[model samples]
Target: MKAFLPPTSYEYVTVHKVQGDDVREASDVLAAEEPLEIRVGYGPVGQREHRTISITMRTPGHDFELVAGFLLTEGIIRSRADLQGVLYCPDVQKEEERENVVRAELSPAAALDLPRLERHFYTSSSCGVCGKTSIEAVHAAGCPRLPPGGVRVPASVIHQLPERQRAAQELFEQTGGLHAAALFSPTGELRLLREDVGRHNALDKAIGAALFQDLLPLHEAVLLVSGRASFELVQKAAVAGIPVMAAVGAPSSLAVSAARNFGLTLCGFVRQQRFNIYCHEWRIS
Candidate 1:
């Protein structure tokens, strides 16, 4: 049987559509965005401790995958073995808020680094040299430099990715406001795809799905994002061991720097059958 999934889009809002003096009232579909509180349950059998980890604004579907990907990319839980289970918070009294919260139970053997986690959240919320500092911290967190020559893709394949990803975006076709992240085989076959109002959240859901399937260290995969590449997105891809990342839009300067530092192949403006390889060009054939 297919698993039950939550709704990812909403259509309750009515809007006025005016085009060339042709105005009419129409119902519109929107990519659902809601706050998800991620809680972690840790410690030994009889001395378990539960703590709220983060609350992020995200689309409603794939909540479990989002939590798993967030934990992995944040350097919280290392692997699937570190996770005991992920479930909705049943104690939430209001029915509507029940699915809005999720808990990831950690194995007793999994070490909890509260200080590092706290520092991560702080840096994320701050400005200034946080970009440079965050990149350095990723190094400090033991995100390995991607090994050289393990994966390669053709420029022809890269050229076709954006269109393929867009075609698979069911929610985006309806709302036209969702960002997407997808994992593809080196040969350009789409493996997993996720959509969200937040770019990073979409990536987390995709990576989280891979994690649940024990597909981490995605050394042979190509990651494609529907929007511009950012530092956070690059960092998350590097942490997940994705070798090559391509974006339909431009990449920030810091994103290029991080990709170079992490030895990841970064591609930007991947449309019109052409793209710019910001770093690690050898990965593209």
Candidate 2:
């Protein structure tokens, strides 16, 4: 399916442009950025409890997918069955507030460790997890190391992804200010794409789309991002069971380290018909 392009993804604004003393007023399109509040309802059937979990800045669209992806990657919920329902907050009075807020109801059978989640947010907000601790936390969250040699992608297929990813980024082409995450087949066909102001949010949207379609543990797929690969992105990929990840930009030191530890094949600077494989090179033939 083609990527869903939300009308709210961009806004038109009047701007002044100056080029070497030549100045003119023109209309410009900018990628829209807004805060999204994610809430969750859990517990027994009638005695459910709700809590506001996160408020993140994102381009408004694909809100449900973003929430679903966040829950799974964070180890809050395991599979699609864990999500009972997802909807906008109906109790909010303001229409805009209602649009900004989303609540995901979890299945009663889905276990929630509130204390651990609380600690996670505290550490994430306070100073961020250290590199070593972050790797350990992935294991603690039950993300297994990827097995080797299940999927092999040709180098030519890898070379074609950046261009395809760019072509599929409709909002970025219009606004020149959004990050994109895409899933591709091993043979290089685009399966899904999502764009957002935040890189992580974009990836979450893509992964969430896969999750909603019951396509998790994306073992035979390749992931491509429009920006540099970070430790967090690598961790998300591993958690999603994606075996290969490629980035148009560079991969950070910790990202490479985590990919090696997780046995994920990571490729960076994936443009100009060339790329660097950080670890598990056997997956890229």
Q: Give per-residue CA lDDT, model 1, range 1-285, as digits (tens).
A: 112335644455899999998999999888788889999999999999999989999989889999999998888888899999999999997877878999999999999999876654523634556567878888877688999889989999999999899998888887899899999999999999998899999999999999999998899999999999998899899999999999999999889999999999999999998899999999999
Top of the candidates by TM-score: 2
Per-candidate TM-score against the hidden true structure: 0.95, 0.96
What are the per-residue Cα lDDT tens digits for candidate 2 across 106-181? 9999998888877754224234677788888888887899986699999999999988998888898899999999
Scored by lDDT, the top model is: 2
Q: Cα RMSD for candidate 1? A: 2.1
Q: Rate the local accuracy (lDDT) of all candidates.
A: 0.89, 0.90
User: Candidate 1 clashing pairs?
Assistant: none
For candidate 1, give the lDDT of residue 2: 19
